[model samples]
Target: MRIRATVATVTAAALSAALAVTALAAPAAGAEQDDTPTQIKNIEVNQNRDYTVVVEAARKVKFPISALVHDPSGIKSVSFSLQHGATEAEVDGRIAQVGPSRCVKVDESWSKCEAVMIADPYTNVRSNALAGAWGINIVAVDGEGNVTREDYMPLARIKRKTHLSLADATPEPVKKGKNLTVKARMIVASWEKHKDVPLIGHQVLLQFRQGASGPFKTLKKVRTDRNGWATATVQATVDGQYRYDFAGTSLTQARSGLADFVDVK
Candidate 1:
């Protein structure tokens, strides 16, 4: 009976030591689980130009986020409803959510997500959706429920299409002292119509070059009319080329290609 009692006491002590070790380990495991720092890397957007978001991580992010992501399903949640400049109210309906199928494992520690954003004029546009600066809010959740979030990503929405052309020039070959009439047209995308339309009341520069390999000199600044056309008159003094340059706006910039040469007698 004395030997049996000693054996039972030893077993109880061992069990208590095992329970103490497990209690000490529980907090450590929880700390490791919460220490994950999931982050966005190599974030890029195809905005005015295809560029990496290196400057502010918030500036010039292209609208419609899905267009930039590789896998749309990887992104857990995203929102462009926050208007930094515009007066549009936050609409939760605009929030985009992606499923697990769109996410792909980059490694054991991280995953890549992708999603798309839709532009709604009534709900998305506050003042002018196009040709304005905006903000985006994002929340990324991994399979382990580890979350990464970023607010106030800068975005610029510019969807303008500009065109400049030297429509007609009087008398292909003319005497040196003769007057030359030049007509040009400028076209830009209409924000309301979603199509190319005339850009009225915009300055168009008429430039002239003395020779084939000479630098262009601005001869005149003409403004487009209701028809998006500008006309200028100049004296034919030398055999050279003529082109039109449309000074871009906050929305778009355009320049005419090399115009056909005009030979002066």
Candidate 2:
């Protein structure tokens, strides 16, 4: 009886160890799969169903137009065309637009030649858009009804290269009907890199916007110099609160999308 009990105890111990090992291994495998980008070639969409555009970073996240898009009357399916701050945004999912900012493609879908859905809405002057804190826009229902149109931004992956500062970190707020000359100093504890691989001297993309709903606007914004320093001045026309963000192509140690707000009223 003594020997039998001892054997049972050893068996139980081995089983426990195996179970623990498996538990740890399972999560790691799942995480890798989640982070891995999906492979798809094109983006195509029809009217009726609205498109949700999300831009978090600079890399082009691949998505299969058929994975979640069902071919139906309301366009249960869609695609994306992404252009990091260049005029034409991504089309269905892979066409690169680099001309104007009014139409991603006038083939049928309404788009800016080179436009950000929510950011500047102005891409003609955008340079190094993918390198800083910029907003991305998707062309959803133009009129908000069942219409025959090529869907823009069928899917979105919220990715960003820079780390945003904390909200309320910028200068003080100003009242409405005013403009701003935003500026700040960020200590470059260390340098960061971007997936877009900006030039040698360019380190950060400086941007500003009025209120929370305004496009990630940039008015005379400056790029980060060799010392990892940057500054920008934004002019607001009708603002309640104005804010700006310091963003890099690489992750900011402080955080991504860090912002400081000021009231205009």
Highest TM-score model number: 1
Which ten-residue region of model 1 has the weakest summed lDDT?
1-10
Distance from true location, Cα of 138 in model 1, Å: 2.9
TM-scores, all candidates, are: 0.61, 0.27
What are the runs in model 2 whose C-alpha is more than 4 Å off? Answer: 1-164, 167-171, 175-179, 184-200, 240-256
lDDT of 1 by residue, 1-265 (tens): 0011111112243344434433443333434344344455544333425321111111222232422222222333222223344322432223232232244566554554444443433333212334444445444443333334444434533334566775577888889999998888887654455455787898888888887876888999899899998888999999988878875655564456456578999
Give lDDT per model, in order.
Answer: 0.51, 0.32
Task: Give one digit per residue, the lDDT tens place, for model 2 in 7-84.
Answer: 111223334443443344333222422221112223322111222222222233222222121112122112223333
Clashes of each: 8, 48
CA shift at 74, candidate 1, in angstroms? 12
The CA lDDT at 160 in model 1 is: 48
